[model samples]
Target: MPTHVVFIHGLWIHSAAWKPWQDLFEEKGYATSAPGWPGDRETVEETRANPDGLDNQGIAEICHHYADIIAGLDEKPIVVGHSFGGLIAQELLANDLVAAAVAIDPAPIKGVKVLPFAQLRSGFPVLGNPANKSRTVALTEKQFKYAFGNVLTDEESDALHAAWTIPGPGRPLFEDATANFVRNSPAAVNTHTAVRGPLLLTSGTEDHTVPESVTLAVVKLYADNTASVTDYHRYEGKGHSLTLDDGWKDVADDVLAWLAAQEL
Candidate 1:
């Protein structure tokens, strides 16, 4: 059976965030879907106005939502995710619901701790506040520059911020950063090894949001005991915006090559 692909967007964005990638994947004969999380806004204006609307959504519910979509597909999917979306991909894998996974700049999986300056700065807005756990936070111009736009040109970064960026829920970041939790989310506990399928970890060399060090930590933690195949790649001259940057097609093509190798 041909592999199905489900592209999950991270916090602040909705299913439309993956439109560019969806178009590229569809052309290559992979059936694709991009589902929105609960209370995800349909428009940028709406998202900006109500960034906290979905802050209460927990990891388990989101994981179950994606799993339902995967269950509906006749064939298991090769999940592709970025940032928090990457975290969700691992949760799906934990359920043994996917054939393969491609995590691009994925957020940290449990027990993986190599926080880079960039990630720290990107998360500072919420990481500093105790109340942020139940609220939303907007990335300021300066914060966004250091966190998400460190590698992009001034003009390009400004355009990207204006066009696609939205305020994001703070709870996940709080959960991701918190050292102790009684009720663990699937991502907060390292159980993805249950997945026997192939796994690929891709990180942008210039990606400050999820630096190489952090990606390495996640890879080592998850790949340690899994008997399945795993691989890693670093794209030079690329930043956190690898999905929509000038060389996005290069990343997409690289994934296609990797997918061809799997013959899924």
Candidate 2:
């Protein structure tokens, strides 16, 4: 089957960060699309300039936005997403909108426990400010380092932040953090459906943003969900930026290999 791989960017960074992945996927014959968020810009500088670009957006709206992009596709695309995008991929899969998916160090969806110190620390820059609930929150170099670049060298961390970081809507982080309290939360996932297709969840060993503990909980949530197959992979010494860090190609290659094994 001919597949169009739709790459989803997570919070802060816009779709531009996925260019390398898109190029590689297309080179392998998968048509690709990377859509910007509701009001995102072309570059990190542009997004940072328009810091309020993501104001008021939450999980459901963003998921539906990607759903709209998928609906316009010629085929049911394989969704590859990282960070918040990972959660979105799971949501899209739950809606039976994708052929297959790979979620790299995905933020926890509703019902997943939030006990890790690293998870809380990683989200602190935005979560610490309640005012951020209605506005955009940008990460500081130090904060970004702790959250996404702990495993990289100082130079690499700063460069990665400069190239990919932008202000993000704090509302979704707040919503995800408190999703269990909300009735019919958008963060909810339907793991019991076979139509959702095959899923592979990968976690970086040192990812504070979405620790392996969180991913493990996500896997357990699907334990009784035998209808849709789920697989797990863990990367040692990597951080939250696993998909974009120096070892990105290995991660991308593994995603392709997993899809091949699934015969997708």
Candidate 3:
């Protein structure tokens, strides 16, 4: 039977960003989909045109949005996500909805204590403005380079930025960063859930957005889960853009190999 693989994209990018991965996964005999976030349009151009469409969407709303889509699928899907999307994969696994989950450079969920300077700088565009909590945020090219493309060539980074970047709602970023303080609507994961299928957390050593230390803390949260499999792996010289960078195929292949082990 063909596996159902659902790809979820993080903020500041459109679902089309996952097209290459979708094609690769499909060629491997898996059914694939890259769903858009709430209020996201069909294309990146459309999303960039009206950034306001994504404003005010918090983690709760976005998580439920993907959950509803998953509820309509024919089978439990293998969820692969990047950045904020990674957090969504965890959320779905918590609900025991996915066959397996892979989170690459996932944003800090509740209880992740390692917030490095790079992570904070990458998030400054959204975090700088208190009012941004209810608005859309777009990164400048320099910021994008620093956050995602730092490991790539300047030319490659600039071209990638131009090709695939969009505005994103900042509410989720705020919700995630302050999950500990806020009791309501925190994007918290149930690390001890035994019903969850296999989960793999991948990190890039060069990733500034979600550093390796943060991923270590994320793994610790699930350390007590003996019933389900949870593993963490890292790639040297790769950044937050491992899923979208030039070496994305190599990383994807490694992911498929690991997922193959899950038999999920």
User: lDDT: which candidate is best?
Assistant: 3
Per-candidate alpha-carbon RMSD to the true structure: 2.1, 1.2, 1.0
**What overall lDDT goes with each candidate model?**
0.76, 0.86, 0.89
What are the per-residue Cα lDDT tens digits for candidate 2 across 1-264? 557888888887768888888888888888888898777877778878886658988888899889998998788999999989999999999888898888888889888875699889888888888998888888887888898999999888888888888889988899999988988888888875555789999999899898889999998888888777899999989998877778899898889889889987
Give the per-residue Cα lDDT of candidate 3 at 141. Answer: 84
Q: lDDT for model 3, please.
A: 0.89
Give, for candidate 3, the lowest lDDT window spanning 10 residues. Answer: 180-189
Candidate 1 displacement at residue 203 in angstroms: 1.1
Which whole-number lDDT from 0 to 100 does residue 177 have in model 3? 80
Best by TM-score: 3
lDDT of 3 by residue, 1-264 (tens): 788999999978788989999999889889899989999988888889987778899888988999999999988999999999999999999888888999998988898877899999999989988899999988888989999999988888888788889998999988988988876645788998667889999899989999999998999999999998899999999998888889999889999899878765
Candidate 2 minimal-lDDT segment of 10 residues = 188-197
lDDT of candidate 1 over 184-239, digit per residue (tens): 64557344447467777888888878888888887787656567777888888788
* Greater-TM-score candidate between 1 and 2: 2
Which residue ranges in model 1 land beyond 4 Å of their true spot? 179-185, 189-193
